[model samples]
Target: MTTILVTGGTGTLGRLVTERLRADGHEVRVLSRRAQPYAVDLREGGAGLDAALEGVETVVHCASTQRGGDEQAAQNLIAAARRTGVAHLVYISIVGVDRVPLPYYRSKFAVERLIEESGLGWTVLRATQFHDLLVTLFQGLGKAPVMPLPAGVSDQPVEVAEVADRLNELALAAPAGRVTDMAGPEVRSLDSLARAYLRTTGRRRPVLNVPLFGKTYGAFRAGGHLAPDQAVGKVTFEEHLAHRFGR
Candidate 1:
């Protein structure tokens, strides 16, 4: 059995991947900032992380920091993996990180580069934004009387479970550098997505399309972070909402 270590193994996607791998009879090791038995920070490398990586043949890297320091985390992981002679490293990254100008997106792309040059056998999968994130945004926005959204912005939100399944498959296979992109089934406008959330959750709020002036927003407006061609995911945002809310 291939013993695979999953970073950020407790997160939405990683947790699913961990469960799937274990169910399939693979020995799964979970590593994260707070995961029990291997709660070491990847950014702050130490013997703790090294100890976790020992005998870890494959690493499914799902750990990511949107606040910052993702590049540092990848570097630390790469260094540790090299030392431990880990054969395969699988990374999950956001789609259009190379085209998007957002700071968080830039950091994701930088981490992708770090993994690419890490010299360890690696596979990277770029996926669209998860549906749960849209839910979070709408939840926050619905708190106010008026919801504000970037003008001309569209999103293709995929189910997190689907992304997790793909990651699990990648972790089990031989390293395939930069696999095909994963995307949601539909491309809907943010305004429409917000409306769907409001309608489903019964939140009465006027959605305001606020046109923001910035290169980052412009890129979003231009659909730089979208993948209309690779819409292969089976679940829809509404289906996810039904299951999440037990409706």
Candidate 2:
């Protein structure tokens, strides 16, 4: 059995990856900020990481700081992976990191470059936003009677479990640089998504379309984060909501 270590193993996507890997009979070690069974903060480099990487053959990197500093954390992880002689480094990134001008996306793109030039076997998988994220966003906005959504913005939110399954597959295979992008089964406008969410949750909210003027919204409106050609996910947003809330 190949030993695998998953960074951010307690996170939403990371937790699913860890569970799938463990269920597949791989010896899985989870690295998290909390003091869990095999905890190691990627921001700090030390013996904890050394122990976490001990005899590990592959690492599925799912840890990320949504606020900032993702590049530094990735750098620390890369250094430790090199020291431990890891066989494969699998990184999960957003779909529009290169095209989007957001700070978080820029940080992810920088980390991708670092991994590509790290001289170690690596594979990067860029995926669309998760259904859970969309749900959370709609839930927050649904609290108001009139919800304002970004006009001309659309999303293809894939299921996290699908992304986790793909990560598991990539972890077991030989390193392949920049795999095909993953996306949800359908492309829906943010307005429609909000309406659907309201309908599903039994909320009566009028979605108001507000024009978003910014570089980030521009990229989103331009479909920078969309992979229409790579819509490989099978689950629909309605199905996801049904599963999530038993609607």
Candidate 3:
């Protein structure tokens, strides 16, 4: 079995991908800030990353920072991969990174470009926002009596496990650049999702529709982040909520 390196393997998607691959008897190295032997901050490329990428056939890059440093991390990873002759580099990105003008999206798009031109075998999968992320968002907003959500914005959220499964498949198979997008079966509005969250947690919070400004908000409102044609994800947001809340 080829040794695979999974960056951010301690996180939700990485953990799932690592579990699946390891269960199949593959030698999987988890690379994170605290992962032993492979422990190295990807933002700063160094001997640690080179050591981790040594003899690694494939690298499933799942590490990303919302605050900053994602571009630097990918550059570091790519440099290390090139140095160690990594054959395949699997990346997971958002559906609308190229279309949306948000800071995070811009960084993600830049990373994608870097991989595409990295002169290595690469497969990039752009997936819709995760259900877990939506839960986190609603949770943070739910603390207030009235949750202020972006107006006219809808989300087609795929399950994290599904995305992980897809990544696992991509990690094993030959590099296929820019595969089909994976999205939730249903495209539900923010208000509807918030209401479902309220029902699930038995919490009442009036959702306020705040019309956000700028191109980012406009793109989201225009459904730039949606993959209506590729609504291939089976799990619904309601199902995820039920399972999470033990309903």
Using TM-score as the measure, name the better of candidate 1 and candidate 2. Answer: 1
Candidate 3 ranges with C-alpha deviation above 4 Å: none
Which pairs clash in model 2?
Answer: none
Provide TM-scores for the models: 0.99, 0.98, 0.99
Off by over 4 Å in 1: none
Q: Please give, for residues 1-247, the per-residue lDDT of candidate 1 as tens digits.
A: 9999999999988999999999999999999998889999999989999999999999999998788889999999999999999999999999999998999999999999999999999999999999999999899888888999988999999999999999988999999999999999999999998888887887789999998998899899999889999999999988888888877
lDDT of 2 by residue, 163-211 (tens): 9999999999999999999999999999988888889999998889999
For residue 120, model 2's alpha carbon misses the true position, in angstroms, by: 0.9
lDDT of 2 at 84: 91
Model 1, residue 80: C-alpha shift (Å) = 0.5
Tell me which of candidates 2 and 3 scores higher on TM-score: 3
Estimate every model's Cα lDDT from 0 to 1: 0.93, 0.92, 0.94
